[model samples]
Target: MNTTTQPTHNTLFITCFAALVATSFCFVLRAFVVDDWGHEFNLSATQKGELLGVGLWPFSISIVLLSLLIDRVGFRAVLWVAVACHLIGTTTTLLATGYWSLYVGTFVLALGNGAVEAAVNPLIATAYRHDKTKWLNMLHAGWPGGLVLGGLLALAQGGGVDWRWKIGLVIVPVIVYSILLLRQRFPVSERVAAGVSYREMLAEAGYVSALIVAALIVIEVGRVFDWSLLLQGLLIVAATAFYAWYTRSPGRALFIIMLIIMMPLATTELGTDSWITSLLEPEVVSMGLQPGWVLVYTSALMLVLRLFAGPLVHRFSPLGLLALCSAIAAVGLYGLSQATGVAVLLAATIYGIGKSFFWPTSIGFVAEQFPKGGAVTMNVLAGVGMLGVGIVGSVLLGTIQDRAIGHSLAAHDAQHATQLHATYFTSEKTGVFGRYLALDEAKVNASDAQTRAVVDAVVAGSKKTALKSVAVLPLIMLAAYLLLLLYFRRQGGYRAVALTQSPPAA
Candidate 1:
């Protein structure tokens, strides 16, 4: 056993919030630099998707492992590991020369990210056990705040700035958080404080939820790497056996269901946020607005709104509020797909508001419904959300854009398509939509005026198509929220569970 004086609740809260800001900075950093990597590496759309997802899926590995071990290892120790990962990961990324190196860098960075969430989510929940939703929202306000700051920094650097230097910006937040967290002592998780056993906490997650998340991560990795059928089968069987052995309780069906729902919710939020700047670039350029500003604008709205989520949660109830957001976000995405000129602002506003509460509110819900589940439940849920965007959402959206562009061009300019086909398309590898064209920089640079125009039209159309396609995700979320709202209504109303709070001095 280890003993250390816990830091004040306010101090821990601020440190965790800074950690999240650093994490969020890492999340959006790629979106700004991906095109540069594409040009330098001759990356295909699918490859770019893989790059985006790389920052996410590895998070699950670290979070899952650490969530199980955090109680034994101590939070401060795990956090120091996180700090090292961030420093080394950023250095690795800056020094990267090729695809594999970049992949390694991103994967390591995600390890730090996962570690942060695993340590901090439970820290904040325990620190403010009585008002988990409100404080959690306040803590998560760091995400959008970081995005807005990063967006502006990207803008000030201008589009022509070096990718390495742009990525180096994250070092600032990493240092800020490090200074804040390095010496602070962490409080025990609420469950541990309340004398809840590890087995009881593990049982709250159960075999069903664990199995579902495990399968999704396995399938995503397998799909990306083209794992052999036997390998996939073995992994599935292993996961099944482990979860079956560990989980004894019947489990909370609603909590398990929410884990699955988090996939689409993540897709609707982070996935969309990842692509929004690229998706709106053509319109933003035409309207004399910087593409980065669109992200900044949306993220600004998210920052402000999330800070005030407490009142909204109080008025609408979490499920009811989420249902309302779903409707607005679905409509907003569809409108964004169709919008031109100033109308883009209107659509983005709605979308930002919709996503603002998703990640934090979901965490709050798990804390309320299954306080006994402890850090494992919270980390698993956060891990799944990240994987949802990185593995499924980002990858699928990239493929959608690839196919949409290829198809539109094939229909209108078969000769040019044939030329591009010979230059870029491979018959052996089909993406989610169809055969993908490797985005060859040389060929693109050499295209004639008319060919370039045709390519631009195809790209513009494809981006729009991608936006319209993703709009469906929020519609699906709206339905899920409605079901949850009705369920809560039947149960009387939304009420947060009170766990063991920190002592008076804390």
Candidate 2:
């Protein structure tokens, strides 16, 4: 029972919006400042990948843990934890000197981001139960909204600002959300308010979903501790067996299927977006566009489209809209891979429109289809997506670019290749870490004319090849979405599941 005075819907909406802004603010900063970090620290590609991925993987931990606890501990308490993490994370980031400190700071920052999603998603659902999809899309518009603000600020700095100032963007939103959320009443989760038992909520996530989360945890933890793969594999197997025995219900198979699909969906969109600025920098510069402007443009497209998702959802249906968007995004990505000069804008617009609706619409689909699953369902889906980006997407993008560039450079100048390899590449684990090459922006800029020409060719080729590879993910998602549309169609079209309220105890 929520005993405190209920907050106005306007206040909650604004606060939730701010929380997402802060989240995106943290995420988008990597695009602007990661090269700076690499240059300053002489970090390898593996180290940079770890650094950026740290900013994401911890999201999985915080969201999964908080999802299980939020209903029990209450929304206010979980929000305060988010605030604390943000403050602490910012302090760590400002003080960071090298690889270890930067990783810790990013990890802490991601914890707060995950907590925000865990709290706010359910908050909005409880606040505007009838319009979860529309409100959620509107709430999520803040993601690209933050990107626009952050990207413009980076561009204004002429891409030369202190990394600290760029990172400080989150502070304003943190303070605003804190003020808006404090002392306000928080409703019980829809599941709790409707008198659904706690056990039922846990069961909705199921053993399979739990196994996936657990396996990711093992993979991440093993990476940090330098644990052997054999050891990690055994731990994951044990976790799977334990969850299978623990969860008696076969669980919501359809929801579980969506969770699986979320891996590629998340990796393809957020992962690709994270690298957009760097990948397109050469072409954008050649065309006299500010490098960061392309990101701002794409983000603006997403912000506008998400704000109007209500009508589109009504017309196309959520799954139908996703299928259409996936096809467009695939074409956009392929177009981007092949684009040059001012042609990049057209390609970006298509990509932006394609990716804009993916994250929020997917959330809406799960919410509408599995309302009985409650916070766990929503938060786990979110957790899976974040983990995918942090673990698979970030590392994969970084590694492929490194390898492609290395391959190109090796063929161009063997001596320069040696220098570049010494400067950029490093060895780490097999799966995500592998061999990474981190190019130095300062070094590349200062190279002699012949050397600069060679470097340019390598970067351009690597980026194009990487984009073409990632375009495959959206193509896969298109097929999956189409199949889901057919599934829903056969079942009398998409419909929201409404749990019947239990009468109060006599």
Which candidate achieves the best lDDT against the true structure?
A: 2
| CA deviation > 4 Å runs, candidate 1 | 1-7, 223-226, 414-435, 500-506
Off by over 4 Å in 2: 1-7, 414-449, 503-506
| lDDT (10s digit) by residue, model 1, range 1-506 | 21433448778888888998888888777778877887787676667777787888788878888999998898887788889999999999999998778888998999999898889889888877877877888899998999988878878998888899888998999999899876786777788877778888888888887777777778776765888768977898788678768776646888887888888888888887777777788899998777878889989998999888889878887777778888888888998999989999998887887778888888888988889899988888888888878887887878888778667756764654356545434323355344656545557757788777766767788888888999998788888888888888899877876665433232
Tell me the lDDT of model 2 at 113: 93
TM-score of 1: 0.93
Q: Across residues 1-506, which tens digit of lDDT does each residue of candidate 2 receive?
A: 54423456677788889888988888888777876787787665546666778888899899989998998898888888999999899889989998788989999999999999999888888777787888899999999999998788777877667888888877877897889777566666778777877778877888889888889889987988889999999999897777667666656988888898888888778888777887888889889877778889999999999999999998998888889988999999999999997789999999999999898888888888888788889989989988988888877877788788777766665754356545533333344655334566666666688777767778778888888888998888889888988888899888888866553253
Lowest summed lDDT across 10 adjacent residues in model 2 is found at 422-431
lDDT of each: 0.81, 0.82
Q: Report the Cα lDDT for residue 443, model 2.
A: 67
lDDT of 2 at 470: 88
